[model samples]
Target: MEATSSNFTLSTILKTEDPYSSLMLAVAALVAIFCYFWIQGKAKSKNGPPLPPGPWPLPIVGNLPFLNSDILHTQFQALTQKHGPLMKIHLGSKLAIVVSSPEMAREVLKTHDITFANHDLPEVGKINTYGGEDILWSPYGTHWRRLRKLCVMKMFTTPTLEASYSTRREETRQTVVYMSEMARDGSPVNLGEQIFLSIFNVVTRMMWGATVEGEERTSLGNELKTLISDISDIEGIQNYSDFFPMVKDDDEKAPLSLTHVKSLLMDMVLGDSIVEESHLPKLPYLQAVMKETLRLHPTLPLLVPHRNSETSVVAGYTVPKDSKIFINVWAIHRDPKHWDEPNEFKPERFLENSLDFNGGDFKYLPFGSGRRICAAINMAERLVLFNIASLLHSFDWKAPKGQKFEVEEKFGLVLKLKSPLVAIPVPRLSDPKLYTA
Candidate 1:
């Protein structure tokens, strides 16, 4: 086991009478990678609560070689089921803890809320989010608090949201009119596309006011969405540097390139009563529908990931400082212990309960919890509720002929429909003016 420099020489290790120089260099790299992990394992803390149990790691690569990043949320759910709620998995040199149960989630997000306040900043996230200085990824400190306050007080305050009421109503009106046109033409519309555009317009109008309008504004929104989708696609790819930042990544064409991997580890309903923002309070069933949809499909399934600022113990397991933490809200939302008939889509069940996006309930945190809860909850609720109600009240949806309706999802960065929804909207409103702005 002792060192033998002669054994690693180009001629000796390559075992070729005339070994190519690049081949010799590649062989040398393999030996170095082996040594790096060996030293890292030995250098880790020996005294601490033992790390949570997980699948056995393989040499230098760790548990990463076993993960399928495309289905990482579901994959983590499966792993946590077998390894317990708090499971530790090594992604290269990076130690990550995945929490899938409500008890463990509370311990991480509530009990040790401050310690786990920061997100595990991925490389793609850094570039897209101004080197991770944005509110979502900024470190837990006064600066982040200021940003949050600015968002809550100045930006998303009730009065401010109320001020933008007309803008929201106008956008929803446009969507209603467009859908009405589709109904008149007997055409099937892509619900996802139309809704995204409406939401996009609402957001832009709120930000830029009515200064930008018509095709230019729509073009801007389309461009922005395309840009975001590109970023999401890039984030979905598992980059080796993210896992092993210690090792500099060579170009993809290199003999030992570790980059640009295709696979990597990383909802709505409607109803009708009044169908306006002011009417949302009285329409408990509509609210329940939104809650149930969120439960089944939490936007950021892992809640942007939490990184422990210091060594901590949660549920009798050690979570080392700076380790990546993932609370699988998707799994917790569907846990049978907390939710009866969790997998089934039952909006009525929510009608009996008081769970909501306020982030109080650990088992159903669609918008996360504690200080890190989403900044624009007020705006989001208004936009979502109003739009859903408007869509349902104004249109009687019909599936494309001979096609079975199904809701399948593909998870990464954010949850996405596996296939786009195609439905025809038959007008169901009493008066045509209700559909106008």
Candidate 2:
């Protein structure tokens, strides 16, 4: 058997069972496994849907260089047009499946929802949120469900929101007073900053009766705004460490460092009382405006990258296990094929349609869909509606003289206005005393 060419096959060598022969057999087995996968991959390329079509990736950097920080969503949307709706992108060594079309979004978010419920956060996100322990980054299971239940039952329920109306009204009135003084002085006001401050005050007041005054409040508000802006900026950045986990992400010194994440993540407002939930039914137009805003600018452009627990087929393509899935809601929301005048700001489109933020509708998932959908939808809706309504009802807004108001958006963890909304507010209320009422 040792000398004969006829018995030189691996089976004969393995059968010899000598120490050297055994070592040779082990090496042969490893080679066989490697070749098997190589041949299988080649066959799959010919016979299976090829990892969904995608733009050719470059070595090492992959598609990283192509994504600009200011307009990453736009860049990704452009790639979808060239690569089809469901595109495969390589970010460093990581493989990301980008679902751009509503159909593809449905597949990832609905049809195979459970299979892709878990999120894969970047290293900075993990370190900031305490190893992704919070509901947003938490893996789907009992812990996530408990958090979701707390939000749905204890925090954002209709009754809880209704009880918060007094706080909402109080804060809204304060904003009105501030705006009135601005109107009297004919001074330009940063509407975005104003709205943010009003909402922040209302939320904090409801949560713990927290109050700030004078220069201190303004300083704190500016700091919080900057913190939010920084978080959004970091969330949009493509950390190579996420794509190549083997590499140290420099978590302490990363563009989105652990410190920044801690500051943003640690600041949470626990609240109960807010806007009258009953009034929501009557404010159809407000809801419509929200829908339109979400359609144009979903808070989370990519909706926390989902990861499949097991390999599965989506849109006829083979999705390997643990592959990261990016549901590009921003791209889907602006697809011309789905909505007329997709890029235009038209709340009227939703006035006649039944599309909503609920996870059921594939064509319009601003908050997302499936088991991993945003848990704070109820609270968020009320907060946004009440704040916007209060701003509109208390004063009429117009851009300051010679200043043009534009809807240009900056992409981030949450979409933001490229410029702070600067406007002149004219008092709408009949009596100045009403501001305190």
Candidate 3:
């Protein structure tokens, strides 16, 4: 009876107070505590390092709601006053590290360039730019390198631009004659359309071996203009897919939904196929005009988002890996630190200076910088310069009756005049002699 009682007591003790079970419970609780802290630390870090500071962000959406659609640059400038040049703002879920100062821009573009080289194309930009096949829209890779090289060597070569010089001269001569005729008739001429047409003629002729005067030119011109207009509008950027990918649902109707709009626009412009190289000049000035236009009026005053690929210090702050980066070429170009009277219209700034737009100089990268700089730089520049030069040399321009040269700018993909540039044209008697031969 004594032994039995002893065994029963031992059994009771084992059942009531198990050492192994208690130890296991303690271990599980410790693990849960550790995991909680770890997750919290990670979340804090993802919010990014202590940035230069800006307006407070809401949960999830961040400073997006605070952003004004019409005056994006102005809004950004306002934030700059509170937060120094290098500041951070969250646009929806995306983190935007804006570099308003030239010094910080230099560091981002020059020192730690590779980290910020890849581009993230917004959905609207992608659809408008031909499924991102064109050099400007393409990401950094073999295709981009190949295209870039081809553009430099075969298309935009000094010899190629020189060869196309006569094309411009001829176009200019025609424009001068047209203006002279219009002046003689005393009829109101749409100088803006004339200028646009003249440039378009020259560029298209060089690219596709046809001028805008051709039978199909009107249709093509309308299509091209529509495409450009759609791409440049602010509403395009306001789409939800650009900010919140998960919110895209076919059944849900939202102001920001882009599905139908993008589809229709793409159908009208890209309709049926890609734009082949045969459709464009294999040379540079054709590309240059495009680049210059963007510089004058960048499609996005701020480039797409970039991330710090590696941990590094910039402008005295520790820029951790995956930290968002922005290069404000618009502000940088305007800043006295890099440019003089940056607001003025001066294509001569490029010609006068040794500064090239190859992402080397932070002062004039309309296309952004680093590994992800614009793929279409070579082509865009060639097109823009070719056209601008062609128009200026071809005609002597005058403001329409009672109209002054208004350079009021409207921002989009490229800066466009708030009012399409309308002017009067008086033909030069001796165009070739009056302008540089």
Clashes of each: 1, 3, 36
Question: Order the candidates by TM-score, highest first — what do you get?
Answer: 1, 2, 3
RMSD of 2: 12.2
Candidate 2: tens digits of C-alpha lDDT, residues 165-282: 7777677666666777778988888766666777788778867888655566556767888887787566556566778868874112111122222233212211122234355566
Candidate 1 residue spans exceeding 4 A from truth: 1-45, 211-224, 249-274
| Top candidate by TM-score | 1
Model 1 local distance difference test score: 0.76
| Order of models, best lDDT first | 1, 2, 3
Worst 10 residues of 2 by lDDT: 250-259
lDDT of 1 by residue, 207-233 (tens): 885533454544555566568777876
Candidate 3, 210-326: lDDT as tens digits? 765434433555566656576567333645755566675311211111233224332344233322223234323334334444554665577665666667667766565655566
What is the alpha-carbon lDDT for the whole of candidate 3? 0.58
Lowest summed lDDT across 10 adjacent residues in model 1 is found at: 257-266
Clashing pairs in 2: 164-273, 164-274, 165-274
Better of 1 and 2 by lDDT: 1
